[model samples]
Target: MPDGTVPQSVLEIRRDLAAAYRLIALEGMDDGIYTHISARLPDGPNGEKRFLLNPFGLRFDEVTAANLVTVDETGAVIDDPYGAGVNAAGFTIHSAVHMARHDAVCVLHTHTVAGVAVSSVKEGILPLNQWSAQFFDRIAFHDYEGIALNLEERERIVADLGNRFVMMLRNHGTLVLGRSVAEAFKLAINLERSCKAQVAALGMGLTPVVLSDDVAEHTARQYQSAYDAMELGNQSDPEWAALLRRLDAVAPDYLG
Candidate 1:
């Protein structure tokens, strides 16, 4: 609330989360005017329960800490510099996730070419290769509706998401929810990679080298650990650091 140095911890989390979104954009995961990312404000000793998200019209690569909007649990914009407010439609999608999923601190959605392509497949994500191995038996699929603008649809969305971190919105796109921004980003990255590889394999008409059930199970277990994102203060994740630098090079004004 003050203009002085932001608390080191909060500043770091904000930067990391913003950086992740920009990287998503950089990696060609954003669909024209769709997709979004959200982070639940950390619960402090006093039990504060706010959250941070992007303004509806801003490009992901153009997002920054100062531009991020803080909103209450009810989806009311608390302090929005752009005065654009939260994407109510996006809120409907994300709030249902945040409310039902207590551990879901960050939610990232994408509508990449590969993601939508894979979502359209009846089989969903297969154990095509190692890239696809991460989601071996872990992908959830949701039937396509026209748009995600109805609050009433929240129940269905939750039911569709179930207990999985990666969800494919049939004929729509993909989503990854996690306990932290870094965790969510990692999941989204993997999901996109899996989809891309699957699309490539499909293009080549080559049968995918499916993984054994045992190995797929083992890989999923290894990916289940909660990410240590608190140490992101120094960009502990090289990938994240490199992503921020990439964004800086391409869209430096996003740091506004």
Candidate 2:
């Protein structure tokens, strides 16, 4: 808050984000300790933006609310009690979105097999089914720029992302954004499911019938309407609540 102290609100964010890490690991969407997920903290006392990110060597399942490092806008860790500082490249990717998209409070990036499979293809997120339809034309693609260690790449990442909620990092992985950790977790899971389904369908060797443009657009609109309601506070996400219940039952240590 005023000094180096993290307010209770930020602690709640850390709890939710740690839960997300555990859930991702549970869902088989994590890649060791490589990929990263980040949540933007409320403006600090000096009004400078801060972020919460996983430390460099912790597996997704190893993350805990108490261990997430807090970093400033320059991607420098400001508070790392465990001395496990944030990953520089991870910060490079996440900071781009956090700084560019103010409303996207939670940004999740993954390097799952299915996600990378979809990202490698020229056409990203085809509408082969209902789950896929949700992101039919709603996904953005950013060409892989080496290891994202360079700060200059942040601008290009922002430009490529535009206003899309989902981004497939070409030949790399998937990135999803949400207004909250719950929403971000939901979107990431759905995107991963869609990618897995797409890979399975493509392996069948049959020319899978793709959804028609009209149908895909209509289905996307349906998904968008639900997102609108959720974003506008008209309704709460039952799935997010249920997932959190499941996480608490299975991995309550995330709250630490």
Expressed as tens digits, the lDDT of each residue in 93-143 for candidate 1 is: 887888788767688888888888989989888886666777777887789
lDDT of each: 0.76, 0.86
Model 1 regions more than 4 Å off: 1-8, 43-48, 225-236, 245-253
**Model 2 whole-model lDDT (C-alpha atoms):** 0.86
Assess the local accuracy of residue 7 in candidate 1 as a C-alpha lDDT between 0 and 100.
31
Q: List the residue pairs that clash in candidate 1.
A: none
TM-score top scorer: 2
Backbone clashes in model 2, listed as residue pairs: none
lDDT tens string, model 2, 1-256? Answer: 0112222378778988998999999999998888888998889898988999998899999999999999987779889977978787778878888888877878999999999988999988889998899887788889997887888988998999998888999999999998778778888988998999989999999898899999999998998788766765668778777888998899988888
Q: Which portions of model 2 show Cα errors greater than 4 Å?
A: 1-8
> Candidate 2: lDDT of 246?
92
